[model samples]
Target: MASSVTKEISYEELKALVGKSQNLLLVDVRTKDEVDKGRISGSVNIPVDSVEAAFAMEPEAFKAKYGVTKPPLDAPELVFHCQMGKRGGTATNTACKLGYVNARNYAGAYKEWCEKEGK
Candidate 1:
């Protein structure tokens, strides 16, 4: 299914989902430089620039490359985040453009995460 819009998740909702949802895939869209400083504990770095490439990868290849299960194009609850809302929003738009119907952006990104969850 082609997605016309990107979904959104609040910091509190995302935090709760992280605690409770094993099926969640939290992707960090920040660059490697930003990630080198620190990142959320369970987030896998996809870097926004490479989102299309990641999605284009074959199922096994996507898993091998990203270290996470590759959900189908119409999969539910695939989320993206970055240092702030901007990159994450862009990445989510990119994912949706690539036909990832459930692509979601965590608007209150790493900065907000730090405010709520700390270093």
Candidate 2:
């Protein structure tokens, strides 16, 4: 069945979610090089520039990398974050257009998370 898209959490809410053992799909839409500096725990690395490519990958390839089966155009819950809100917001929009039912943009992104969490 087709599912409805929704933003179930804000940046602060996402921080709480991070503390809990939730089955969340947290994506760091930053370059691999940038992620080498630091990143949120439990986040998958999918550079914003490569999201389209990643989504277009074969199911088995995508699953091997992301650990989830191919998500329908609108099936999984995705939380995208970048250095600042800009890239994350853009990534979120793209994912929504691609049919992610619950794609959220973490406005604070990594910078905010680092500042708040003192990382």
Candidate 3:
């Protein structure tokens, strides 16, 4: 399925980015418990419920609210994912509306990640 966001990153691309970039902001939009099961390495949890508050706060406040540093308005990339794809897509759209043009969704999401790991 086509992602609503223009910059949808595939699982392969995301895996490469995780290894290559330390500054990339990877967010898991699943619930806390879903995340507790496991999340992509380097991804911070941002449960879809709190997306607005995370993006709308001041830099310092954003960091405290979401437990991740606020990427600059022109940040290069902010990647999001959920267990499947829906909530991550919602996050990508919300981030764009909040002026984070760099936000991208991991189209394959965490379900794909787990499946691949079991292979």
Best by TM-score: 1
Worst 10 residues of 1 by lDDT: 1-10
Return the top candidate by lDDT.
1
Positional deviation of residue 55's Cα in model 2 after best superposition, in angstroms: 2.0
lDDT of each: 0.86, 0.77, 0.85
Residue 12, model 3: lDDT of: 84
Q: Please write out the lDDT profile of model 2 over residues 25-52, one tens digit for every residue.
A: 7889998999999999988888888887
As a whole number from 0 to 100, the lDDT of residue 4 in candidate 2 is 30
Candidate 2 off by > 4 Å: 1-9, 19-21, 67-76
Ranking by lDDT: 1, 3, 2
Q: After superposition, how far is residue 58 of candidate 2 from its true place, in Å?
A: 3.6
Model 1 lDDT tens row, 51-104:
889888899999888888897887767889999788898889988888888889
RMSD of candidate 2 to the true fold? Answer: 4.8
For candidate 3, list the clashing residue pairs, or say none. none
Q: What tens digits encode model 3's per-residue C-alpha lDDT throughout 1-119?
A: 44455468898888788968977999999999998889898888988989888888898988777677999877887898999888888888888888887889987899999887773
Report the Cα RMSD per candidate. Answer: 3.1, 4.8, 1.9
Cα error, candidate 3, residue 48 (Å): 0.5
Candidate 1 achieves a global lDDT of 0.86
Error of 2 at 93 (Å): 1.1
